[model samples]
Target chain A: MQKEVMFAGFGGQGILLSAKLLAHAAMNQGAEVMWIPSYGPEMRGGTAYCTVIVSDRLIGSPIVKNPTHLVAMNRPSLEKFAPVVKSDGVVMINSSLIPVRSGRDDVDELIVPANDAAIEVGSVRCANIIAVAAFAARSKMVDLEILRECVKSQFASKAKLIPLNMAAFDKGLELAEGK
Target chain B: MAKVLMKGNEAIGEAAIRAGCLNYFAYPITPQSEVAEYLAKRLPEAGGTFVQGESEVAVGYMIFGAAACGERVMTTSSSPGVSLMSEAISYIAGARCPAVFVNIMRGGPGLGGILPSQGDYFQATKGGGHGDYHMLVMAPDGVQEAVEMTMQAFPLAEKYRGPVMIMGDGMIGQMMEPVEFPEDLYVPPTNKDEWATNGMDTRKSDTKNIVKSLYLDPTVLNDHNLLLKSQYDRMKEEEVRFENYNTDGDYQALIVSYGTMSRVCKTAIDEMKAQGLEIGMVRPKTLFPFPEKAIHDAASKPGCKVVVSIEMSMGQMVEDVERVVKGKTPVQWYGQCGGEVPTPQKVMEHIQSLLNS
Candidate 1:
């Protein structure tokens, strides 16, 4: 089985980082994975998106048009992607930014105040970590431990941000559970 | 042999270093410029030679000079830059010097675009340098393969006495993926006194070796072409690599693609399969010795009706696919050139239309 997820938002919102972290977590679980980021002109202040494919078998393509999961970090991203989510697929929206809900009833919609949750934890930059933690908890796509490992690896060089990021991740898990 | 996350270009440089290649000569080009930049720092640390030649033209000849000295040497460029290197590439092929060249292709008819493009298919497989010479072209779609193929390319070049190219696009070059370096370093055979014109002191007779592609006699040139053909024939027998996906079932259509385009085709196939359409893919890993036999076999399968060639170029490899299918399967072409990649939806629509027709 294969699952494709797209994380899209404005630049510096950590959309690309979140997608990569999920892909890395899937890879650590011994799954075949691919992460493709938007390149060229589309990357500068435009909608920066990344596509991640995680599969039990070898992944065929890294380009995903209809993703099983769509994580929209902004209103523009949610407006652009809500229509493309597959039936019964999950669409996670950052409630703090996006006001409207997904139009499709066939899919599962989760509105998490990712930015607010991150702010509550410490900083707004941790919003991506929060979204990733929520996605991991709800989708069960990858183990929470693996997500933690991915987070650690991503920030391994930074070293000092580990504790705060872990706290932010925990807060995200609680928020996901509350939903 | 632990996996480390590395950009594709960086991995290729590391692999080249581990292959015991001492001399690296290259100019900077986007998507693949990282390879030169990485080697600039890494090669010196490893006590190897690294020079950023003034231009791709100079870099190619610099490689020629090092290869002539019987040292394992390499150079890298993208499409437009590679066009400049073609002059030297042809010279190197004609002189029968072994060197590894990496082309991390960007879109181009002429400085086309910088995204990623497989449009150099014809240039890489059939148009290396010029005149009846074929370089072994290896198309690596991912970072791990990029690393492994680069390490393998040097020895393969020496084994065949010609240039070997690791052809990839910007996506493969710039993207970061996990790759493990090979456990053992490959030490190529020393041929300095034998073939290279290093010096004449050690030989029994003090004679100068001339390294030139200019064979004045027509018959000698014909003989040289024939020898190259024989070597190509041997390579055809030895080096066809491909990946087959979901080909067992009765399929309405088959997708033929390679490199980054193949990855896109895979996603399209999966989505089509979910919609109850049976489709398969034949992804060629080696472009030159064009997996003709595999194409033939795939076409011959029962219930395989239409074969579509998806590429980043305008119908270059499609001709080869048509040649191999032999009029049995209806062959078609779908492509986007100048670095514009065809999305999975576009590919699916093309397949759906073909299947419906």
Candidate 2:
């Protein structure tokens, strides 16, 4: 099995974290994975992003040109990356922030209000976690339980923060499942 | 082996410590700065020393000083920084002070951008310094391989009693992957009393181990160069490392590459395989004592037609490939410079045109 996922958003939105969570879960499940960020001066600000590739076999190139799953957490990310997703791939656009739809008819597009969902649950910083849950549920690329545990481990050093992140993850999962 | 995820740069740093290296001196450079950053904390914890040199030039001498004392010393830098370290590298070579250095390469004719490129192939395998020298060069593709090579570099340097380099591009230094470092590869080096310049106290007898490269005598300098050449010849015989993929089949095309470019070529080969095109790849793990015979053998496969050298440079390694192919099969070159890695699609298009023409 092989899947390429790209998580794109503003620098502070934890795009790198959500992608790291998926990459960690894939490794925990015994798959070869690589996580490459949009490194260079472009990373100083503006649209920050990272790509995670998980495969049962050796991954040839980590710098992917077209990802199978695209998680656009903002309007700029959607506008830039939506058309590049594979024809049969899955895309999750943050409906609360990005109002534009990925006009591709061949792919599955899930409009997730991750920002509103995170705020409804607890913290605004949990928006990336919500997108992670939505992508996990929609693509079925990784086990949902594994993804949740990966998310919780991100806050492992801060014991008091786990419960809030879990609540945010559940709210996002619920939204994706209902759609 | 417990697998943990880590960036390539950080993993290389951790692997050096695990390999029993104790001294590190480096200056910060993009893409490879994480190596120094990671080593700063871990080296202290492991009872090792980590120094951020005032400049790349200073770090080069710092490693030479530590290595002169028989420590498994190391330094890391990108292309531009490596240029600054070249003079010291030549001294370390001439003096035969064993040290490990990593060059996570970036594009460069001069201060080219900080993105992944393999333009340093010639500078690395051929000599970046102003002397006749050969650094045991290991080019790794993934984080796991990078760790293995970093671990092996120390022993290789000590064995040959010269400089060793782990050559990789910015991608290999920046990308993250799951890596399990080998527990048994951590080898403590042998006693350096035979050649290393410890203090007058360390030498039991009156014989002083003066580590200096200045052989003003013409006969003495020639003898020293001949000694270095002899070790390189042995490394070429015993230390050559490479791997082949799908080469057993009746292949019509063979591609020679190393590090990240080889990985992309594998992707292109896989795509071509699905369409019933047979293309094999030879990834040279060691770029210096570069698996020449292996290239000749792979290119001489029953159905092999053309041999192509794919790289991120403006076609540097192609010269070495041609030297090995020796008019057996037509040697071709494909490359892109200035930090731009040739994508799989682009490589495939280029290879297809080569085949069709």
Candidate 3:
């Protein structure tokens, strides 16, 4: 099975990192994965996004026009991408900041209070991690163990921050499970 | 061989190292500056030379000096800087010096932009410098090809006794992909005592071997040009490479593209196929020894109504397409110059419009 996922948010929302982590996890699972970022001048404060494609076969196109899943960390991302999700596709929305729900009924929508959940975990910045956990739980595209391995590998060089990030990931998984 | 994730620019640098290129001289330019930066650290570890020359002009001359000593040498730059080095490139060609020059092409007519573009098609294939010479140009679409072609360029240059160009765009330079270095590849040390001007006593003959492009006599210049033309003719016979996609069936449209632009075309072809539009793509893997026969064959196809030349330039390779098509088919051109890449949707639209018309 081939799946395309887009994670989009403001520049500081860790959207690119989250997409990379997903790609890394997919790679660890022996899936062919490609992570492409919105490069060039649009990379300033403007809404940044990355498209990750995980496929059991060779990936033909890296650019995804219609994604199978979307992790919308902010309102603009939801507004921009809600309509493009495939039928029965999962969209994990950060409801703490986005007031409205997806207008499309053809797809599955999960409204997790990502920001509020992060705050409960003592850091609002871990909202992306929360969204990632929700995506893993809903899609099962990658195993939680592989995701944890990706998180560890990402923070391996910085041993001090590993505990906090691991805690953040576990907290995210817990929040998704509770939902 | 094991795979390692590497950027295109860094892979070129590593490939150059594996190809036994001991000397590298370059000035920084976007999309390709990473090659210079990478070699600066990697070269010393491999016991090679890496110099950030004062300017592109100086770097070109430094390449000339190193190449004259029979050392495996290389240099890299983007559009404008490449333009600056053209003079030296011409000199190198005329002097029959073997070296590798990589242009990680960015947009251009003059300082156009820093984004990736295939605008240098004419500049690269038609000889950017002032001379009746041709550099063996290889256009790599992916990262693996980029590394492989670059490693192959060094020996090819030596065999041809001329410059070889690894022409790629910003995407191929900046994008990260998996690459595997050749297992047996290693840099061979140059025998400095052979042709090098290190000391007079070590020379084979008392007379000096002058490596100059200047031949004042018209007859001598004519002979030199004829010799270079023959080399190019031989290159055309041996060096053309292209990849054909979905060309077996009758195609309504024939798409010709190269470098990063071809990747976009592949996406467009897939999309068009879903919509029931029969399209075929001829992606040139080498620009100079262009697949003229392949282009001609595609154009000569009975159902192939239009030949669309998609490029990142304002219609440079279109001229070559026209030449090959020779008025048998309507050769059309679509391009976005100065680092703007064409989208698959846009290309599909162009093809669809042509099919409808």
Deviation of model 1 at B210, angstroms: 4.0
Q: Which 10 residues in a row give candidate 1 chain B its minimum summed lDDT?
A: B183-192
RMSD of each: 3.3, 1.4, 3.4
Which lDDT tens digits does candidate 2 get at residues B29-130?
A: 987999999999999999999989999999999999999998899899999999999999999999999999999998787888888999888888999999
Q: How good is the docking of model 3, as DockQ? A: 0.31
Candidate 1: tens digits of C-alpha lDDT, residues A30-71: 887777777777676587988888888876666667899999
Candidate 3's error at B107, in angstroms?
A: 2.7
Model 1 sits at a Cα RMSD from the real structure of: 3.3
Per-chain TM-score, chain A, candidate 2: 0.96
Interface RMSD of each: 2.0, 0.8, 2.6
Best by lDDT: 2
**Superposed Cα deviation of residue B220, candidate 3 (Å):** 2.5
True contacts kept of each: 0.45, 0.64, 0.06
lDDT of 2 at B46: 97
- What is the C-alpha DockQ of each candidate? 0.43, 0.78, 0.31
The 0-to-1 C-alpha lDDT of every candidate, in the order given, reads 0.86, 0.90, 0.84
Fnat for model 2 comes to 0.64
Instruction: Identify the CAPRI category of the predicted complex in candidate 2.
Output: medium
lDDT value, residue B296 of candidate 1? 86
